[model samples]
Target chain A: MNPFPASDYIVAAFFLFCIATTVGGAFVAILTARVIRSVCGLMICCVGLAGLYFFLNSPFLALMEILIYIGAVCVTIVFAVMLAEPDEPPSGQNHGPGVLWGVVALVVSAAICWGLSQLSLRGPWVAPAARVNDGSIKAIGVSLLTTYSMAFELISLVLLVAIVGALVIARTGRTKP
Target chain B: MSLPEPFRLLSFLVGVMAFVGFNAAYLVWVERKSAARFQRRPGPTEVGYAGLLQPIADGIKLLSKQLIVPPGADRILFMVAPLMVMIPAMISLVVLPFGGSLMARDINVGLLMMFAFGSINVMSIMLSGWSSRNKYAIISAARIVSQDVAYEIPMLLVVITLLMITGTMNLNEIVQQQEGWFWHWNLFRLNVNPLMPLTFLIFFTCMLAEINRAPFDMAEAESELVAGAFTEYAGMGFGVFFVAEYANIVVGCSFATVLFLGGWQSPFGLWSGVWWFLLKMYALVFTVIWVRWTFPRTQFYNLLNLSWQLLIPASLFTLILVAAMMKFL
Candidate 1:
């Protein structure tokens, strides 16, 4: 008898789809001509990342990935796009410098990607000796307050400073120097 | 439904979707009649009986309209945004605890999942408005981003306070905590603490803002922005947004019902089931419609001031107060 059912194949197919979506969305994000379309590409990539996170068994992180990236970050980028007229330069005029920059960028990205892939694939892949936490929301909350409390407080402080800095910068151009 | 199993979840999703569809249609009808009554004028009495079938007429009209793609608009994003909105609005309904056994997914982070998925609705609006290539739509989108950012803080604080009081994030667990008597509902936790009412009020207003209902509906102010982000959409492109808005309202009110009101729990310890859940949800929804017609649209600055100045401070205070109560009491 078949140990694995048709449902298992369906799930595997869905997982493959998620991988395709993530890679395709990222490719579109970098390759797109229109700045706004790039934002859409980023959003699609985020959604795919959510799927990946779901597969990783942290549905909380999956949802938060959608919430913070697509919801807050992309929307703010959209606002900036609206306020500041932006469009890709379309490989304007230069043949030599442009190609040079393109090669440099490509080389950098490829190296990083290859390095990370190797690091992941070459892992020992052994289970941890002991479990510190269950990775539930409760576990996350407890660790955030207990073990990671300092970092959590620092993050909040950073966000507060960023808001203040934004306001200060926004207010500067209006007042007479 | 337990969701380690996929086959059962697939069937349950199908049923839940049908229920959501019926809820959206019925809500549109209710909203129309409620608005007519508030205005002291007759509603669509010609369609079926007492305007019972007006939503069908509206649906037919929307469906029949031409789907025109404006030349300047981003073709793909314009097409995709409506579906984007419809997806998350429906997904959020999955985790909402309707009754003892009426939920689809009872994950521990139920309320957080709702909030997380709900944010995508705002993102979709941003995309649609940005893609439309209209100044009004762009402006509306910008306004919405700011409004969402401001209102979300107070709402999160309210949710956090509730999480502390109830000592759980699961919607089913939260609802179970409020069982037996109506007074046991978290809204009137006045016996243990005085901050619950304020938190509830904060939650209600934030819920209205989150779903883009009036008087907080300045982003879609019809007269000012010519229907705002929806100015360029036509036919079912617009229809999808309309359906999604009503669906979001239902989801928001359902959330409020579960969080504050005694969800599916009886007032007098009598009949209980999904019916009581439906009753509480609809009653909250009716109040949403009632408030929409009664209040005038708020000014944009005034709206920000209300959220940032009033609601934010009040909610933070409530959060602190509740924490203290939990510590000492």
Candidate 2:
């Protein structure tokens, strides 16, 4: 039984807030003309998605979402924007190929949306008979080190290669004195 | 009799809020007095005895002053940035175990959660700088991001070293493992990790950089960047930034206390309680303030080099050394 009767209402309100934040942030990301604002919008969307993950009983994933996306990815984007031009180029006119391209883009997005909603709504949503683990940090750690050990090592190897490649590229641009 | 669940949660939240508010106010006084002492001068002896009422007066002054947005600044982001900096640090206080059974929430991943919220701190600084529309602030923002990114690696490496030795991410559990004598503490657990003290040093160094304290305070290097990221903020906006900085110091020091110095555990094996926790935490804070007053602000390139070049390899070495010791010894 629930101790606080109003807790359900509170949870529902928070859920609604998360949904609103996600949708609102995505809109800002897409509709904003400034690149910096768009990056901020993306950060907000990631935060909202983290909240949604928390609601789905995955606090680990939620924390990782915030840690990786909002912390690392968004900050990197902001850093890049700071170093580069931060504003979008102005659209010249409402007429011409822009209007046609916009219409076609809208149609494509609508179709994708329709297809996704249909697929999700009609898909089987049965609960699994048994969970392999309780999804605690310990469980995740065990599985990571044991079952997914090879995959984990591969990912780390790939990341190391990427880092070295990045260093090489960055080094090439600077002339030796 | 125990309080109801909601009531218990509410009381804990309120208690943590009060504790944060008190620390934020008084820590400024502590720093001022300590800095004064280091310089051989009387600090604030004005408002009340030893300037006890100074923070209150300062708070009132900051609150009464006007919050101004520069002509070209982004209004919403500028207004939201200070609150953003303050809130996550406050949230982190909820999970910090003050004494036995004194934590607000005992989540399994409490350490990770604190760090997750802690990571959000850099974003707020970046936003404040970028939104201010000031060149100095923007430069400060850029420096903060790179500084955080560089130090976070060694910080995480050192943490992983401790985690491997302790076998848990829960702050309370980590403390529990270090129960009994001072030698049982992670800092002195040489039987497990021979480089335990060095590991703590790496973590402390990273923490100093992480919280933007002196020597690593490139985010607000006043001589260089004109008050750094919060240059355009006025009154309570600046006041909140000041409060958040102190609050973050408390959080970071508390984290170090928990991870290394043994949270709430008495060193002499006598009465163990919140007092010991506070004693250790404040000692770390004092060290931090002392460090600020003593060392000159480091060069930005040196700051990065310290992290990427020296600290990272050293921490990685400690991690492997600890692992091998655990495996064979």
Candidate 3:
């Protein structure tokens, strides 16, 4: 898989950088008090994830990740943050239930993380024996329009409904001026 | 002798940077001169011959000035925002097929990569505004976000139509499909889709809106928002934003040329090369400048309405029509 053996070090360095960015961004996203900064951190995480996808030989998915996540999703979140309160509620005010909820959240997250790690470590991670297609853009397009057409159409329909719902919700109570 | 791989890569990167820098500097001069002509005045005649050295003068001035951070502004984000704007525009340049052999990197998903980076431009503007901590800037940021979001759909729909027609997301391939005479261009491919011209118009309108040119210059509505999202930026910070804006115009026009007009294809069907691509791209850029001086800034809501109510529907119809045409005929 190493097309240029000499450049493997450079590739590895880039992979490390991506991993670091993803982890650092996730931490910043969770720990940051400013919602806007958190959104930026999420954007950083998405970019690193896109790089990882590129490493996985799926440049299409990688570009789509950046296109959809950092471009659309995170920007929309920042827009919402701009419209709404842009900061998290300050901590240290709540006493008991907040602490209890924190513990519950920590436990839940830990359990889920442990379970996922275990699953990944133990699961059958074999590659497919043969591929139906070369996984090119054309193949993706064909499969999308043929084999996955129903699912694709359904997803789009769902998105359309969600958009209409958002418009309806946002438009409520605005008087005709 | 051929250069080593690293040296070749470095040279390409340097060339791209220089290209982006030159365009950023001179497009401002072109815009100012064209804008002045539109208003019946001589523009920037002082610095050099017809102000040919104006951008250099402006660059030196910006470089010498102080970089001021507004008090209470988020310093890190504020400083990074300008870079954010510039870097994505620069990255998108790597994928632009300037000519048959004149691109830096010819990725298979070049079109998508260009667009993916284009989306980041909106995010950078949003960040710049939000970090400024100014009420006016925040308001402008909101407007920019919605404007971009609305316009991107129609633009992408138009692109999807082109993709379906060409069956490739490669920018070079898209251009190759439009090779030969002017009529073979996507803009005039009436036999494939009768609404090709209308589709081109939709794309052009969206490109204008996406790049925040007039009448879609809500991001910097100086009359209302006082330089809008970038009010807090000073000196080089402000200069970088403007350069990035011009660079984006270049990128957008180039994308429009590649997607619609016959990129690098000589209209006469004779000699063809990067010069034709440059000519077409600059022509579109001139149109953008012409538009800015011709039209007053549109009312913000009207801009959004123009996208949602007009361009989106029009582009979507073209998309479906093209799809049906391809499937049946």
Instruction: Report the lDDT of model 2 for residue B249.
Output: 98
lDDT of 3 by residue, B115-229 (tens): 9999999999989998998999999899999999999999999988888878888889889988888999989988779998898888889999988888899999999999999
After superposition, the stretches of candidate 2 with alpha carbons farther than 4 Å from their true spots are A86-97, A128-136, A149-161, A175-177
By lDDT, rank the candidates, best first: 2, 3, 1
DockQ of 3: 0.52
Name the candidate that leads on DockQ. 2
A1-177, model 2: which lDDT tens digit per residue?
Answer: 247868889899999999998989999999987887888789889889998988877777888998899888998888888888645466666788878999999999999999999998998877533444666666899989999999999999999998999999999989788
Worst 10 residues of 1 chain B by lDDT: B1-10
For model 3, state the Cα shift of residue A58 in Å: 0.6
Native-to-model Cα distance after best TM-score fit, residue A32 in candidate 3, in Å: 0.2
| Pairs with steric clashes in candidate 2 | none
Give the least accurate 10-residue stretch of model 2 chain A, judged by summed lDDT.
Answer: A127-136
Cα lDDT for residue A120, candidate 3: 91
In candidate 1, residue B258 scores what lDDT? 90
Model 3 C-alpha lDDT per residue in residues A75-167, reported as the tens digit of each score: 888878877875545665778888999999999999999999999999988753344466567899888999999999999999999999999
For each candidate, give its TM-score against the true structure.
0.93, 0.95, 0.94
| Candidate 1 structure quality by residue, lDDT tens digits, B1-329 | 33445655787788777877787788888888889998998877998999898888888898999999899888899999899889887888889888898888888778888988898888888888888988898888888888888898899889988888887778898888888778888898885569788788899999899889999997799989998899999998998888888889889989998999978888766776789988888888999999999999999999999998999999999888888888888
